[model samples]
Target chain A: MSDRIFGGIGLVIAIFFAWQATLIQTSFISDAVGPKTFPILLAVLLGISSVYFLLKPDPEPDWPRAGRFAEIAFAALVLLAYGQLLPEIGFVIATALTAGYLAWRLGSKPLEAVIVGVGTSLGIFVIFKLLLGLSLAEGPLGF
Target chain B: MELLASLGDGFAIAISWQNLLYALLGCLLGTIMGALPGLGPSNGVAILIPLAFTLGLDATGALILLTSVYYGAMYGGRISSILLNIPGDEPAMMTCLDGYPMARKGQAGEALALSGIASFVGAFLSTCGLVLLAPQLVKVALLFGPAEYFALFALAFATLGGISAKNQAKSLFAAALGIMLAMIGVDTQTGVPRFTFGEVHLYDGIDFLVAIVGLFALSEVFIFLEHRGTEKDATTGPRMEIGRITPTWPMIQSCIPTMGRTSILGFISGVLPGAGASLGSFVSYSMEKKLVDRDGTFGTGDPRGVAAPETGNNAAAGGALVPMLALGVPGSGTTAVLLAVLLALNITPGPLLFQQNPDVVWGLIAALFIGNFMLLALNIPMVGLFTRVLMVPPRILMPIVAMISFVGIYGISGSSFDLMVMLIFGVAGWALRKLEVPLVPIILGTLLGNEMEVNFRRAVTIADGDYSVLISSPLTIVLWAIAIIGFIIPIFVSSTLRRKMKKDERDLTD
Candidate 1:
């Protein structure tokens, strides 16, 4: 049942890629098969293989447990927020929140997470910007 | 003779204070990351890739540090596997088999020390192999043409299939999909945009980092969410002492044969694309099982099993660099990250690297030596300290890891678009994993996609529409033969093993 869903998705994605490859510009290099050829070949290969696997996969292997999925979702969302805020909130503040959140998830005490998160952000700032002489943009928080 | 000169030049590059500092930093960071159970060398290297980009050092120096981290993590991973029973990565998985057993027997100190020594031996021996074999391999590589390159890629795909035996077809499909995705940017040939969907950022093509982080790290989050754990013992065995950091000379001597054999095996296997350190460790462990027990005393806390896999994995780490350094091809996903760095630096890695960039080459070689020594120093005394990382609750640690992944990826482009792609890739990657597909091949396929495309185009261009250019060159024919034969052999070997396994199962049932 799962296989059919994935196979269908794979087939659609393959078609999308095939159609896209056909539109790419191919002039920098010399006389050749051009850019479209490889992607089209890949699409065909994927379409066929997806069908094959959907028909016959190995004996079921254990998938990751439920908590793992939650953790992944939480991380992805937090990371998405981190990227959105870094430029506006500044590296130090954004990073601190990000770090603290991660530390919390990883098992640090609440206070410890905040401290470590803030400390890590400052430390990175000092090392990269001050010591290494790389310039990082200061966000709205101004630190 | 020629090799000696190169070694001398490499020494000159490595001995400098700046490069030495970079190597030490890389080693220290790598050890810390490796000691963490869930974070392996690949993530360590991947997470810090943006830093390398932001810092923008000379190609050689950047590569030296990155490669050093890779090498150090290979050694440092043993620390966790031995003390905590958590393998840092797939290669270290074998170490847990006997290492944890030895640790449970109150030999944590001995296990840690032995594994460390085994790692040093494996890495050093593989370096020797690289020094001896690289130039010769380069010369042989010079004979390759477009068709040969394609054939080499085929062999890589085949090996990936073999390694992922349970779902070879699915793995290939994923790989092919990755290759197609790589084709989304503007075509260099006719100036046409392929799959951009009108987004300007997509024109630069998919950044390898975005794909990798999504596939490996982000998906890891989802997987982790599914499997929450209960509390365990707070304390472990007697704390490791400084005196127990080094293996006894006699103990070292006893395992020399296993170490030596695994090093060679690991190095040889590592040179072939798609056959990463995981396979190297497995092959080595099996070989040790055969040699250590004429009558079978293996896997019952025998030090040979631990030593064999540890040595094999470390050596394979070093061996894997050969293709990366000499041929510009990565033997595994981690090295492909390095390849991306090289590309970003406008450094083309191929036969051209040695001829055009001597300093980078030598500096990297030198960094490897320093990096290994530093790893040993850092890991030996700190085994007890690092083992404590396991005590931390996954709840807190998971959040911080997520944050790092978020900040690191965002720090790169400062664009929400990249983050969005990351999310999509994460979900896709998770779905693929659920279907029993291997992730390495997808990354590998993406890394090799453009190369294959260009070469195929070039081959045809050279032939001027002639269909026989693929077989016209002797080198191409030879490579094609090797690819075909190499692929068939694995299938034949695996079928025999499968039959033997089934028969053994039936015997047990009766």
Candidate 2:
């Protein structure tokens, strides 16, 4: 997005936050500036800065091309999916799958990627769970 | 003197076999981390906080290890900058101007050696400064009340804004957004949720580590992915000859003066809340170029050119520790991560830290002294080995980094929700970086937001609701003046400088 559009969006978010700040209910007011004061101050500062950005945007906004957007989106999806699957499928399996996929995407041979994936996954599991004694999510195939 | 006595005690703790070993491990890990492209001291420390906790080291041991890593990374950053022409971190960016030229000229080994020595000298001397200056600074810090703290934070913000990317407004906005994020969770004073939106997990607020790891490490991975195929044609430079790893005595002698000057300059810059290692290295390099490199050989493999930035950056690393040690404020992002570690350990840093936790404070200082020496020894001999890390392909390295971030955060919080938060912030951080919004101020704002609010409220309460109390104190007045000037001068100076440069170009054309 262009700086002007991003700034406009930021301004809207800041306005929403400012309104939310007004709704914060404080039970006991010990100080002159209660809980809402700082948030309001921050929201106002953000709103003003957004307006400044809208007034003068960068001439050449260095946005990534559409070609590279797919890669970035894929990586983000992989991470989000990894987070979701970490507890459900457990550490080793989730890590292996995600790491393998990412490595392969980045140009590692499929076999090398698989080795790296399983190795890193098990390696970290051993280090954190066994050596450091931290509890990690255990998969169906324990250890 | 009490300083001497405390330092003596510090040595006793630091010299213990366990602490010494931890320091060594930290230095080794820190150097490896620093040598890796796109992973600097801040990311190194942030990614390893959980590991430190998992090891169950006492506060002093954990601090010694982590701080040793911090210093070690400063030393190791020059390795990649000199060898691969890819700076391992921002502070090492200056090193690339000269170090890369030296490498292309087959003086890579000598460049690496000089930077190692320079880093040692810079870190060692600045640590000595820390030993001497921190106690006195802490005494001054003890005198600061809520009003003073508020002003001090303002000064920090203003200075950060000044040093941030050319757009001061954007930097301020990012900082404000960070503060807004910090407002999530239940308010300590009012027992009301400000922005939690009724989520039970939001009661304690967002974890700063999660934010840091996502913003720095994960965001870095996304960028790495964006440029992955583009760098396939890039070549690793000539292998460093081991025999040339040791600088000639005269070459070392020439850099001594430059190192001395830059170390002092770097230390002072590091002590400032906003100006960290990058500024120190930049200022030192520019100053050295103007002062000594009159023949115009600065960017073309000059040893002194390599020395100035290497020394300045490492010295600045030591200097950056002062605020976090003396005042509960972090002077840089890396130190902010360190502060987070301390907070996680249930240790509050400030004037009281010295009296309340002398072992943690003093032991860390003494460990820094040892860590610098260890880094010099490790970096000079292992320069070749460290450079080999550049050969590690991003495909393998980046996924491991991601795993470390995932496992490390999970180890600490043991919550899947935080992992999701990290992933979300990682994408947000990448977008923000693309937009040129500086991340340091955001981290600083989040770290200091609660304290800033608490101090502001406390000052107001003490003044019986008189808002003027914030500006009443002499110290606060001076800080406010500095803050205001800091904001105005940078914009004014840069514009004039740009105008002059343009006019000069036009004149040359004529």
Candidate 3:
């Protein structure tokens, strides 16, 4: 059951946190309680609750695995790539690509997505760079 | 009398051509963002924070714009719920029960009218409460110390299990995850890296804006993908006839009580961290259900049902400000974001706020009055207009929202690095949604993480590592007791609900 798994995971996480806190050296601010105290307490609580959940599982069904995984993964990667790529291409191009890809994934036709993407990029460029006058990169691919 | 004089000065500053423009811009953009399901006031502010910084507006002017956006979004949230049975925010969900029903029966215009009126009433009434109560609250907040603050944080965290999810442990896990994430970055007191893993950017810790976008906006995108290819037929309801958009006199009179009670209840709830407008709405709905039920009219187009939560949620938005300005503690996620902005502005909110920075305080108070009226006027004529926004396809809308988020972030740092972090978190946030872990805690954690750590450190140093120092002070002891009570009572109540649910199922089976 999901509760059992969640509880087990929680317990492991609590233990890991407890271990991490051990490395935190005590100081004036850390004092007698130190950084480790609260985390250790939380770890124990998590460990206890996880065991309790294992003993008494609820009957409700877990959320269905909608094909959301693929969309989320790809879109996230594109966003990460966009961030890294923004300095290479200008803000407008990088933003347009990011928007275009997201739009397509959201079910817009390619042409529609591209148009929206470009429109968004231009809109942002006008607002932040031109109107607000925030200095942004004009990269290798000029604005 | 003095309040009026101060208010006059506030208006003088707020109504200046420059400030009015910022207020107007914030209100318009805020309404649109708030109307989108899943994006609330916090993100609305966080996404645009960098812009405020870039513009370098006077602190008062910037605050007015962001605060307007905050309330404007609260007003806009009602649109989606009334029209499409989709709540723009969780608090708006109650409105849908009666609002959408009314819309289905060809009274879409009337439903919009009622929600707008209720939102205005809630906002107006609570601002009155703010003017009256804020000073007194600040005086009380002056007595608090590190122990009390920690206790307050604990109490706030305690409420998560009550409202966040069905599983209490999961909520606790989420809260712990938040606490740990808050612990990330350099330890303020010791100058040691807690969880930075040597990432230079992270030495400053996870930015709340990046975390918030990931938790709310990006996670929402992922959730939207789940409901992908599952578009319902565009809402088909009666076309409106006229502009006499007033509720029946009796209906209006009845809602006055609901409005009054919800405003008070909402303000009190908003004064507490973790218990937000969403919870206030839920609590008000259930209370109204118990109090004003006769023929099951509460849900089936009974206007009171729609009005109660609307009033509660909106007033709760105003009430949430009480702690932020008075105590320097943010009572909800949105207020947390506002606190970050205040910190960025070099304006620390607390008892001294009233004496040191009366302009920011009075300006905010005065603007609440102006903003609420503007929102009402805007919401009424624009009801039909806002409904048309829902007609736009997700493909187009998503790109625009994403672009704004991306560009707004880039403008903040003027570095591609921040954008990259935003993307990484956006994806991780989306993925976390599938796992059913709540995202708000992650944000609340990241925002409050450093503050909580620093406070605990301070308490320890003050006590000279005498562990008992955390609870030695009377204020600390009282807060700790409250925190303990807050944590325990909810678990028991939820467990009781779960048991009752099991019994009901068994009876049905038999």
Candidate 4:
């Protein structure tokens, strides 16, 4: 089930943390408790919790089926690309693309999604960047 | 007399056109967001923080605006519960019990109006409670040493699971994960980098605000995607025609005592670390049922049933500010976001906040009272308009939520790196939520992790590394005992109180 998988991941991270804790080079003038102690303590807590999940896995979590999961993955991909594309495409275009695609994915008509996208992009740009004068990426538009 | 003077000063500040305008705006937007299904106070505040900051308000103005949103959202959450049978958040779940039933009986308008009044009663009373109680709590808190502070932080993490958390292990695991995340960046004391992985951005540690927006707001988008159009989307927001907006005078008279009693009860629950509004709502609804449901009419669209939870949760929401303001600990997850904003502003919360920034503190308090009256006036006439939020389906609404998170994070930091981390947290947050791990503790851990580490070192140094110093004082011992009990007892107790709270989770997931 998903519980054991999560536990396995948690335990690995906990061990990684504990190992990293030991690797921390404490300066000579550091206080009685250095950086390693709290992290090590936290690592142990994480390890114990992960073991609980491993030994006492709950019922199988109701994960979505293939198509829905693919949709989620795609949206996540869009968001991932969004972060990368922001500085390049600027906030307006990047936002429009992400917003439009998401709206379309959310069951909007193509034109409506595009409107939502462009509207969201420009709306935020005008309000935040223009009206409020907060900093946003100018990209090519230089607005 | 001193309290009155300070509160009067607060009123003087809160009444300014700019602050008043901000308060009005916050209440309006808060109600709109609160009525949206799947959005709660945490998401509401997180999504809108950029806007608050973008407006170029001072700390006092910003706090007033956001805290007004906080109160308004508590008022708005009932809209979905009554009209759509979907709660905006956990605290609103109790409202759905008797609320939707009343709506089905064609009393949706009455239900909305009644809950609004109840919310007003709860919020107004609790804001009064907060003004009277918080300074006293601050006096006691000033006695805290580093050890007691450490114990207090531990207590916060231990109890943050609240009544809705199904597993303590999951909460602990999440907290540790957060602490590990906090362990990234350079160690300030030793000048050693802990887990920088050779990235310059890692030197400042993962910003909690970025993490918050991602985990709460962005993950919400991903969750919407997974359930987008399948029968997994069965929990559709079905709107009821909100007929007959006002409750009869007799009905109001009947419920007056219930509101009065539950206000105090909810405030006490809110003041308790980790209990928050959900516990407040649950306790109030159940307690009222016990005392007055002799005919078993409590859940069958009883006016009192609708009134109890609304008031309790609202009161508890107001009450939750006590710890955050007095002890530098959050009373609920929503307050945690507020606390993070405070810290980001370099305004330390706790006893010193009262001493150093009395204007800000008192202004915020005065604004909460002002917000309470504004919400009552707003929710009554505008309940019909607020109900319109339920009509906006996930597809259109969700993208807006996503855009806000994207734009907000970007606009605030202008750092794509922060946005990138936000996406990771969003995706990872979706997975954790699906696994039933609570998100609040993870946030709390990150928010308090550095301070927890600092207090740990301070305590150790003060006691010359005896380590026994943690339990040396009575306050420390009491806090440690509470932490242990909070972490361990719920697993064995498994009371009906917890089971009923779980039922909401099942209904939600179903």
Q: TM-score of each candidate?
A: 0.89, 0.95, 0.88, 0.97
**lDDT, candidate 2, A30-99, per-residue tens:** 4677888888988999999999989988665556678778889988998888888777888899999998
Model 1, residue B120: C-alpha shift (Å): 1.0
Model 1 residue B238 lDDT?
A: 46
How large is the C-alpha RMSD of every model relative to the true structure? 3.8, 3.0, 4.1, 2.1
Q: B79-177, model 3: which lDDT tens digit per residue?
A: 788777677877787787777767666677777788888888888888888887888887777787877777666765666444334666555666667
- Cα error, residue A54 of model 2, in Å, equals 0.8
Tens digits of per-residue lDDT for model 2, B128-173: 9999888989889989999999998878777774453377888778
CA shift of B323, model 3, Å: 2.3
For each model in turn, which proportion of the native inter-chain contacts is also found?
0.68, 0.79, 0.55, 0.86
Going through the candidates in order, their DockQ values are: 0.53, 0.76, 0.48, 0.80
Candidate 1 per-residue lDDT over residues B98-206, each given as its tens digit: 7777777777777887898889888988988887777777787787888777766766666665442555567668678767767767766666777888989999888
Question: Which candidate model has the greater lDDT, 1 or 4?
Answer: 4
> In CAPRI terms, where does candidate 1 land?
medium
TM-score of 2: 0.95
How does chain B score by TM in each prediction? 0.90, 0.94, 0.89, 0.96
**Model 3: lDDT to the true structure:** 0.72
Highest DockQ against the true fold, candidate: 4
As a TM-score, model 4 comes out at 0.97
* Tens digits of lDDT, candidate 1, A19-43: 7667665666546576667778888
Q: Indicate the worst ten consecutive residues by lDDT in candidate 3 chain B.
A: B233-242
